[model samples]
Target: MNNMSVELNYGYNGAIQPYNKQFKSNFSGFNHFEVGIRYMFSEHLGAKIIYKSDKFVNDPGGNIGIQYNSLGAGVVYNIGKKIGLTYLTRDNLGLLFHLEGSVGFANSLIQQYESEKTKIIGIGITPQYRINNKIAITTDFTYNINLKQLYGFDGFPINTTKISETGSFYNLSIGLIYYIGENKYHSDWY
Candidate 1:
């Protein structure tokens, strides 16, 4: 299987606010980004390392201007090929599902609150349409859970210091993936 590839993505992302009635700064925008490298050991399975950033901002954002940066690793499964559905779309379409784990830090642009770090676990689904032998267009959707998150996006501490407090977010993106090496077809499209 020809399976080395790189991906770039950009799109919208949002975080579910801290459930507390804290004066949370509103955050919204198209500030999600992802860059990753993938390597497949076989036709149906692969692994990847990715870097992701999500920036949330608003006019006069105050603490709303926050950036979350994460580095993650995942195992990928090509569902389309795994189930013997490669006959569709002239074999130009594919779907991938992944489970990932990451560790990252959140920084506030206003410099009022101390930066906080957290571990994250997420699930993602990507649908791809091949444009050529080497390139494909893709859309991705992911949901991530933030573990032991102690601060809100507004850069303020939550009402409680419980170590188990968690937060969640979702990312929706569109971008492209480029397969590398001299192969007639990438594992995604073959």
Candidate 2:
């Protein structure tokens, strides 16, 4: 058996921001991409770090966007032969649960200001189901606290607000895993 598998993932989050009386308008969109990678480890216990670029476009007047570069590490321990327990750790722990205090960064464009940086910190949760050796489904729920104000025009100072701006989104994804090599068996285990 091969110890490693590679995956190609594609999915979309329906609407990011709802229509509000306080804000300008509603934000809704779809993100699509094709990424390639190499995975190393076993299904019972493994870790993977991926790099992906995502592009988002909003409606009304603001074309707010971001380019995220992240590193994630995760482990899977088989409860029996078909059931498993999994945990993933990263700087952007938005897939864990709604909470406070975490560290992450992104370059954002709000309204017409395209040269601003925003720092995000929060906690989140993700639940995943392994359908078989070749497929799995995962859902992520995250709440993010934005450290910087929306770009374009600034009326307030950096330290004016006691609490940062909060944003949350959920994603459902289906992934296909492909084995790329041979598995190494330990004599101690057999």
TM-score of each: 0.90, 0.49
Task: Flag regions of model 1 displaced more than 4 Å.
Answer: 19-26, 59-63, 160-164
Residue clash pairs of candidate 1: none
- Over 112-181, each residue of candidate 2 has an lDDT whose tens digit, in order, gives 3333344444343444454444433445433444454332112122233433354443334444445454
- Candidate lDDT scores, in order, read 0.82, 0.37
- Which digits, one per residue and each the tens of the lDDT, describe model 1 over residues 99-138? 9999978886666677788998989999888898988999
lDDT score, candidate 1 = 0.82
Q: Pick the candidate with the highest lDDT.
A: 1
Clashing residue pairs in candidate 2 are 95-124, 95-125, 96-124, 96-125, 97-124, 97-125
